[model samples]
Structure formats: C-alpha cells, structure tokens
Target: MTKVPNVFFICGNGLGSSLACQMEADDVFEEAGIAVNSGHDSISDAPSLNADVIVSASNFRSQFANTQIDPKTKLVYLDNIVDKNEIKEKVLPVVKKIAES
Candidate 1:
C-alpha cells in the first residue's frame, strides 16, 4: 500500500484555527476515502514540518512567500477553512495526485 500523506493545517498560532481546520479536514478526507496523517501547527512551524501537504487560509500566502519551503511540498490555500465543499474541490485533487505519486 502507498504511504499516507502527512498534511498540516497552519494558522497564526497552533492553538485555535489550525486545530479547527484540521478537524474539518479529517472529516473531508474520511468521506473522500483518502487516508492521511494530519496535524495542526503554527505558521512558524510550517517549513520544518516536512509535510507532504500544507493547508491554510489564503491570507498566509505572503508569510510563506519569504520562507524556503521544500519544492515537493504542496500548498493548498482556502478562503473558508470550514467549508467542506470548498475543501473537497480544492484539496482532494492535490491529495489524489500526491497519493498517486
């Protein structure tokens, strides 16, 4: 079997928003039959996480712009973190591709 991808949900602080988004993403992945190893972390911890995928609100785009992220890591930006439909539409495809790889 292929290894499950490690996905991290990033926010300003590790405490609130990232955790909430991670919870919602868990449900979305389960429904989509995608198995992932997921977690929540602050933006400061992002580059070091070495995740296959990193997800966060679009506002963090500028913050990540200056960071040296791994070329293989896939970033997914969402306008609404709790929106399942949006998550499915945006995140699922990247995850499917990563799984295939």
Candidate 2:
C-alpha cells in the first residue's frame, strides 16, 4: 500500500478563506506526485486528528500561545500570502523533507 502523508490544517472559526487554501494544497501535492491527505479543522479538533504534521493558519501568534505542541509534529505557520502558487512554493520545501525522509 502507498503511504500518504497526513496533514491537519488548523484555522480559527473554520471555513471561509482558510479552508479554501487547504483545498489548493490537495492539487499541489497531487501534481508533485505525492499523495497528501489534508483536512481543515479548528484547534479544538487538532488533537483528535492525530496527524503526521500540523499546518497552522490561525495566525502566527495564536499558533504558539498557551499550547503544548508535540515535538514530533512538524508544525507549519502560514503567512498572509494571497497567491496560492506562492503559498505552495513556500510550503513545498517543508513537505519535501517530510516526504523524502
């Protein structure tokens, strides 16, 4: 069986623009010839997902605020980049490392 990386996308309030960006990530991974299972959810749901990595889009400050993050988890803090391609470019390096390793 092929192994696909599990990515949990965390955002505040859920839905709206944040969820849309995550959907784009699906296509990006697809074109890269790597299958990634990305899902959008709130911080409260993060623990239950048991994801391989956590991608935070709930603003930079909140990502590390009053929270204990798992050391093994690869956390990604997304900046305010509107262009989907640019965002993908920035995130690709991190994804590549996880995939290669």
Candidate 3:
C-alpha cells in the first residue's frame, strides 16, 4: 500500500497562522484525494515533526534552513497564509509525486 504523506504547516508561534494554513491545507488535500496526515507547529518544533512536506510562510525560510530538519522533507513556502488556491497549486504536485513514489 502507498503511504499517506505527512505535511506540517509551521509558523512562528503555532497558534494563529499555522492553524489557519493547516485548515487550508486540509481542503486542498481532500480535493486532490490525497491521504495526508498533517499538523501545525511552531518552527522550533519542525525538526522533530517527521513530516514529508513542511509548509511555512516565505519569511521563515532562513530559519528552517538553519535547523536540522530531515533532509528528505520537501519545503514549501507561501506568500499569503490565507490563499488556499496558491497552496493547492504549490502542494498538490508534491503530494502527487509522493503518491507516485
């Protein structure tokens, strides 16, 4: 059986922006028929999330780059936290690739 992809939506605090992005990600995953295990967490916790994909605001790229996050994890960045369409555009392809693998 193919493994479901795990995705993490990260933010500075893990309370507001990350939670919102998680909700948006859920919708995109559902529409794509992609079985995903997803969660929201602070950037500090990202190194330990064990996710296949990590989504975060564009500004946090430097922070994530400095961490010891798994080298295999695909990093996705969004300019707008509330733009579900953009999230779908960026993430669906990654999800499909994961499914194929």
Candidate 4:
C-alpha cells in the first residue's frame, strides 16, 4: 500500500479554510491512491512537525511568513480559500507523486 502524504494546513486565524483544505486532500487524494491526514497548525508549529505539504488560506496568507518557512517544505497558497473541488484538483498531483516515491 502506498503511504499517504500528510499535509499541515495553516491560516491567519482559526477559520474554516484550513479545515476545508484538509477535507479536500482526503477526498481527492484517497481516490487517487493516496492516504491523507491533515491538521490545523500555526506557522510556528510547522517547522517542528513533519508534513509532506503546507497550505495557507488566501486571505490570511502573509501570516505564513515564507522566509521563516523551510524551503524544503512543499507549499500551496490557495486563492481566497476556493471550493474544495478546486483544492482537490490542484493538490492531488503533488500528493500522488510524493506518495509514490
């Protein structure tokens, strides 16, 4: 079985966007042969834990301070916390490749 990629999602405030992304990853990636587990975390929380990807809600993007973020961590900056379908369509490819490796 392929190991699903974990995604750590962050936002400016504790809102629905990050959680939405998590659900999208589960629905979309699972169909594509990937297992996904995502969590709501702050920018500061990211460096310590391991995650295959990191996403930021569009409205609260700057709170994510990219300079402090590790270059090795894959990131997806969504535009205005769009629909779950959009997140799934965009993120699945990366998730698929990462799981395969």
**Which runs in model 3 stand beyond 4 Å of their true positions?**
none
Backbone clashes, candidate 4: 0
Question: Clashes per prediction?
Answer: 0, 0, 0, 0
lDDT of 4 by residue, 7-82 (tens): 7777654357667666666666667666677787766666765877887766556666554666676877777454
Each model's lDDT: 0.89, 0.67, 0.89, 0.68
Backbone clash total for model 1 is 0
Q: Which stretches of candidate 4 lie over 4 Å from their true place?
A: 80-82
lDDT of 1 by residue, 1-101 (tens): 56689999999998798888899989999998889999999988888997999999999989989877888999999999888888899988888788777
| Model 3, span 1-101: residue lDDT tens | 57788988999988899999999889988988888899999999998888999999999999987989999999999999779888978977897798778
Candidate 2 residues lying further than 4 Å off, grouped into runs, are 1-3, 58-60
Give all TM-scores, in the order shown: 0.94, 0.77, 0.94, 0.75
- The alpha-carbon lDDT assigned to residue 77 of candidate 4 equals 77
Q: What does the lDDT come to for candidate 3?
A: 0.89
Model 1 quality (TM-score)? 0.94
Error of 3 at 20 (Å): 0.3
Number of the predicted model whose TM-score against the real structure is largest: 1
Better of 2 and 4 by TM-score: 2
The whole-model C-alpha lDDT of candidate 1 against the native structure comes to 0.89
Question: Hey, what RMSD does candidate 4 come out at?
Answer: 2.5
